[model samples]
Target: MNPSHRLSTFNITTLALGLAFLYLPIVILVIYSFNASRLVTVWGGWSLRWYFEFFNDQAMLDAAWMSLRVAVTSASLATLLGTLAALALSRGADFTGRTLFSGMLYAPLVMPEVITGLSLLLLFVALGAGRGFWTVTIAHTTLTMCFVAVVVQSRLTSLDPTLEEAAMDLGCNPARAFAAVTLPLILPSIAAGWMLAFTLSLDDLVIASFTTGPGSATLPIRIYSEVRLGVKPEINAICTLVIALIAAVIIVASLAAKLSDARGESGAPL
Candidate 1:
């Protein structure tokens, strides 16, 4: 074989192995979610008993509901604020402290979650604020916004500046021009950012634990507590359900994006 062909084969083999390494644990968890045996190691038989048990566990259900609420609310707020920040940062002329501002925006992305959580907790206590749903929401939004901003900024970077200029030349006001011209182009990035924020918020556990109040415990926190007591098949079932839901959302989003792309290329004006 040629050297290039050998290199291609090596790259493909590396990619497949990397994917398997990342996904093997998830595959095991999904398979064991349906296991009838309480002991995770011993797969007695295929059964849906764990799912039934998860449904019957009211506290776990309540925690899941709380987590869903927090995740949706926080992610939405984060996406909105992050989009605005991205637009400003992307469009604005270079100014004093611009570097500092950018660094601050991205700091949470690299900061240790434990440190962030503890710092927020301390700040809240210092300000006489209580730990609850709102606290968790704020913390989630702070971290999630960084991700959304990064995604949006990347999309904005790829956008043609001439689109905005053309809209302005067509007698549309600045606000109207952006609403008509720029918004459509960057919408996919905004949506992708929102989805990422949602996933991150839903998966967060360390920060939520430090910020949550008595009644504001999220699903992950509940699962962590339960696992500490004893590993339950119901936990596995809940995780599997969450994984399925996220997967479905991603697939639907992908299909919708593809459809939109096809429509855009069909000669109909966007």
Candidate 2:
């Protein structure tokens, strides 16, 4: 084969291998979620019994609900704060401590989850605050907001400042110009960030484990506890549902992004 063809073949093989390495275990788990046997390792037959049991388990259902609530609230809060931070970093005039501020904003992105969780736990303990639903939500917000900030800041860096300037020159105030022009363009990034934060919050285990209090166990925590005893088909069923939910969120985010792009192309109003 020619060099170009050889390179293309190598790339295809690498991609296939990488995808298989990442998803093969997940595929196996999903397939086994329908197993009729109670033994996780033994394949008796295919059935939906585990899924039925998963739904009827009140503790799992409650944990799942708690996780959803925390994820949604934390993601929304993080998106708002992160967007503001992005705007300040990208659009605001230089001020004293701007460099320090930027570093602090992005610090959590590189910080270990264990360290972050421990710090939060200590702070809560020092303040004599109870660790529960809101504490978990706050912890998730702290971890995820940095991710949102990174996403929004990248979009802001590539944005056309001239559009907002032109809007301002045409008698719109800065906030009005941003509302009418800049916000529309950066919305897709904000939405992507929100979805990312939501996923991270939902999938988090270590941080939640450290910060979560009694009676506030998340799905992951509950699953972990269950798995410690033994992996079961029901755990697989719950995991499959979690995977499906994340996949659905990703699909919705993609469609929303495409729609935003189409609107921009069609010159739709903000």
Candidate 3:
């Protein structure tokens, strides 16, 4: 083969290997979720026994529901607060201590989950606050908002500030100008941040473990505890369902974003 062809072949092989490395384990787990036998390793032909069992497990169902609620609440709060932080950092005039403020805003992005969780746990203890649903949600929001801020800040930096100014020049108030012009333009980023925050909060295990109180176990905690005893088909089944749900959400969101972009581009003047 020519040198260019050889390089193309190498890239293809690398891509294939990388994808297999990431997804092969997940594929095995998904396949075994339908296993007829109790053993996870042994393929006992395909059946939906485990799916039925998973749905019938009231504790697992409750934990899943709780996780959903926490994820939604935290993601929304994070998105809202993160957007505000991004606006301050990206749009507002430079002020004293701006660097310190920026560092603090992004600190949680690099902070270890264990450390973050421990700090929050200590704070809750010092405040004599009960640890439960709201505590878990707050912890998730704290860790996730930094990520949302990063995403929104990137979008804000790329936006044309003159668009908002032009709206204001057209007699719109500052808030109305943002709502009519800047908000629509940055909406895709806001949505992307929300999805990312939701995914992070949902997949979080370490922070949830530290902050969760009695009767507020999320799905990851429940799954981890069960896996400690032994891996069960039910665990596989539930995980597969969770994976499917997340995948569906991502696909729908991606399509909506693409459609929005297409419409915006089409309407722009030549």
Candidate 4:
């Protein structure tokens, strides 16, 4: 065989193996969600029994609702604050503390989650803020907003400043020019950041464990508690749903980005 051909074949085999390593467990869990038997591994034919059981679990339902609220509210708040931070980093003039501000903006990405969670937990205690839904939301917003800032900053850095400048020259103020010309172009990144924040909030367990209070358990917390007892088919069913939600968000974000590119190519506002 040709050396180049052999290398290509090896690369393909490596990629396939890597993908299987990551996804095979998820596939097995998804398939086992439909298992009728109480035993997780032994197949006793497929059915929707687990799905029905999952729906009937009131604690899980409440936890799911709480998780949704936290994810949506935190993601929205994070997206807004992150976009502003990104603008400051990418567009604002250099000034005193600019370096420090940029460092703070990206620090969360590398910070240990335990340290972040513990510090926030202490801050809440200092503020006399009771631990609960709002506390978890605050913690989540703090963590995920940094991720959003990183995403939006990349888009802002790559964008041409001339477009916004031209808008201002054509009678728009600075803010108006940004709103009219700059925002639309960078919106795909903002949308993606929001989705990422949402996923982070939904999937988080450690930070939520530190910040969450009684009667305000999130889905991950509830799932963890259940899994400690042993693997239940209901847990598998819930995991499948969570995976589907994350996958859907990614697909929508990708499509939105493609659409924005198409609009840009056609000389339309994007």
Candidate 5:
């Protein structure tokens, strides 16, 4: 065989294996979700029993609702704060403690979730703040904002400051200039940040487990507790639903962005 052809075959094999390794478990979980029997491994034929059971599981349903609320609120707050931090870091002049600020902002990205969760737990306890829904929200927002900031900062660094300057030159104030020019350009990045934050908040188990109180257990917390009792078809159903939702969001966003880009390219002057 030709060396290049052999190398191409190897590369294709590696890629196929890598993708299978990553996705095979999820695919199996989704398939098993329809199993009629309680046993996860033994195929008892296809049925919607587990999905139906999942909907009827009141505790899980409530936890899902709570998780949704936490994700939306945390993602929004994180996007807002993260955008501001990104703006400052990417645009602001050199100042005292700027280095420290940058380091602290990105620290959570690399820090162990356990350490971050434990420290937050301790801080809440020392502050006498009650641990519940809001505690979880606060904790999630803190953890996800670092991710959001990184996303937004990447966009901001590449953004043209001249656009904002032109808006100012056109008799716009700083805030108005941003709203009129900068915000529109960065809106996609902000949306990306929000989506990232939402996903992180929803999938988080460690930080949430540390901060959540009895009544405020998120889906991951509930899922963890159930999984400790051994695997269930209902758990598979839950995973399927979560995966589907995330996939749907990604698909819609990609299509919308593609359409927008197509329009922009069509409208551009030759």
Candidate 6:
């Protein structure tokens, strides 16, 4: 075969192997979620007992609800704040300390979670604020906002500024110009950022553990505590359900993106 063909074959092989390496554990976990055996490795028979047990467990259900609420609230707030920050950073003229401001915005993205948690805990204590759902929400928003800002900045970088200018030329006010011209173009990025923030908030354990108070346990905290005792099939089942839900969200988002692209190409309004 030609050298180019051989290289293509090698690339394909590498990609397949990489995907398998990443997904193999997920496949195992999904399969074992239905296993009847108490031991994770030994599959005595195919059964849905674990799923039933997971559904019937009130603590798990409460934790799941708490996680959902926190993720939704934090992601929404983060998206709003990050979108504004991205617009200001991307569109505003250069000013003093711009670089420092940008660095501060991204600081939490690279900072260790332990340090962030510790700092926030101390700040709360110093301010006489008690840990609870609001504290956890604030912690999650701070971390998730960095991801939102990055995603929004990337989208804004590629956008044409002429649309906003044209809208302004047509007598549209600044806010109206953004709503009519800028917002539509950058909506995909905002949506992606929101999803990233949601996922990050959902998966967070360290910060949640530090900020959450009694009766405010999130799903990750509950799962981590349970795993310390020992692994259970119910944990596997819960994970399987979460994985399935995330998969569904991704698929739906992909389809929606394709539709949006098709509409844009057809000169239809979003």
Off by over 4 Å in 4: 1-7, 267-270
- How many residue pairs clash in each candidate at the backbone level? 0, 0, 0, 1, 0, 0
Residues 6-85 of candidate 4 have per-residue lDDT tens digits of 66877989999999999999999999999999999899899999999989999999999999999999999999999999
TM-score of each: 0.94, 0.95, 0.95, 0.94, 0.94, 0.94
For all candidates in order, the CA lDDT equals 0.92, 0.93, 0.93, 0.92, 0.92, 0.93
Tens-place lDDT per residue, model 1, 100-151, is 8889999999999999999999988899888898999999999899999999
Worst 10-residue lDDT window for candidate 1 reads 1-10
lDDT of 3 by residue, 116-160 (tens): 999999999999999999999999999999889999999989988
Write down the TM-score for model 5: 0.94
Q: Write the per-residue lDDT of candidate 2 for residues 133-219, one digit (tens) a residue.
A: 999999999999989999999999998889999998999999999999989888989999999999999999999998999999999
lDDT for position 143 in model 2: 93
Clashing pairs in 6: none
Candidate 1 Cα deviation (angstroms), residue 143:
0.6
Q: Which residue pairs in candidate 3 collide?
A: none
Question: After superposing candidate 1, which stretches have Cα over 4 Å from the reference?
Answer: 1-13, 268-270
Error (Å) of candidate 1 at residue 174 is 1.0
lDDT comparing candidate 5 with the true structure: 0.92
What would the TM-score be for candidate 1 when compared with the true structure?
0.94
lDDT of 6 at 162: 90
